[model samples]
Target: MQAQQFEKLSLLVDDQLDKPQSVQLLKSVRHDPALQAKLQRYALISQALKGEQAAVADLDFADKVKQQLKSEPVYLMQRKKSDDQFKKTSLAVAASLLLAVVGFYAGKMHNQVQTLAQATTTAAAEQSPAEQMNAQFKEYLQAHDNVWYVNNNAGVKSYARLASYQSR
Candidate 1:
């Protein structure tokens, strides 16, 4: 195959051909062994540039390399740039999602701490056992008038039993 035809075949394999060029190259190179060989070498070079492993062949090595250097496309360079930008965008979105989850948990913990502080402040004002006992004794004393003057032992015993029952 002519070097120029081989270059066009490379463009077709790389999907850089438009409709007219692609149809022309496809019909011309479909049964041409030399053009197929050039396309295979071009594919190998593309794979090597992309950090993929491919088997290298031994035919017309220097000529194929020179042709590849002359025929490299503008779009391949742009494809690499777009791929890098996409990766960066994906990483940024993942970082934002992680930060949102952490912020939500931090806000929940802060609200829980505030609720516990309010409960602690409320727990300080409840009535004590001694204050409750004093109030009950005062009420009992006000309701009875004859207990202070009673001197009979049997009456005192009966009155003590009545007082115990009334306290309950």
Candidate 2:
């Protein structure tokens, strides 16, 4: 058969063709013995491809498995559906409760941090300029308190020079 006819036969086997296309192909296949044989071959190929993937491993594969099962002890464990359902429900409830608790604590912590920040800002706003300058100077001194103890010998000299310049 020609490639186009073979392709049409494959499409018919797969039911990929539209109603009109399928109807026309079916009519042509019904009239021609060659088309009929080609259609059957295509169908067999498609069935084999699908079946091989789904169930069939090789010749006598199922028979071998059946023989093996017959020789082995059979396991017949009964499942308790109630136990499984309860476990699933309990796990879901516990997870939701945990999430709620975490969310509540996070919101509480965030509020506490915001309130503390706001109080500090308010206090800073109340401070006079001189007071603010003194606070800044104290913070600077605390930050650089360890600078004079640096490994380099120039650290003390550098700090003294800076202090002198500031005083001047």
Candidate 3:
């Protein structure tokens, strides 16, 4: 009548209960028609599982299923092939974009450095002869300071003559 009695009935059909419990459950099943019917169903299920009864399958069911599978279209396989190709193309495009970006920045930085070098060369070239000579004289004075004091008045006259020559 209760769920516990039904479970005891199943265990009894499987011969899983101990001797005393089996004896008690068997006595209950002897008096209960619903329990007897349940016991019969359990026995039928056990016989079907053991391949003693053909509860569901016909003889050609496996062959029919194999034939159906063989006749089915391979749409999933075709889609996987397309997906692989798309992944490869997407990776190639991403690599190309990365390379293009690196090359673009490299070219831009090279141009900036080249422009700076050119500006420095042009600035040096545009200096007047007097300014060039003055820079050279200052460098010489720094290197030989004892000579600067020895030829102080002569150095002033020579610098004046150099400036006049540049004007000419």
Top-TM-score candidate index: 2
For candidate 3, write residues 1-168 as lDDT tens digits.
589987887787778889999998889887887877777788778787778854555445777999999999876544336688889999999999999999999999999999999998998899999988987887787687645444565535444356743353
Cα lDDT computed for each candidate against the true fold: 0.75, 0.79, 0.80
Cα-lDDT of candidate 3? 0.80
Per-residue CA lDDT of model 1 for 4-108, tens digit only, reads: 797787787678879998888877766776776777888888888889998777756877899999898755444346777889999999999999999999999
TM-score of each: 0.30, 0.40, 0.31
TM-score order, best first, reads 2, 3, 1
Segments of candidate 3 deviating more than 4 angstroms? 1-79, 82-84, 130-168
Worst 10 residues of 3 by lDDT: 159-168
Candidate 1 TM-score to native:
0.30
Clashes of 2: 0
What does candidate 2's lDDT look like per residue over 5-44, in tens digits? 7798888788888899889888888778787777767777
RMSD of each: 20.3, 12.4, 17.6
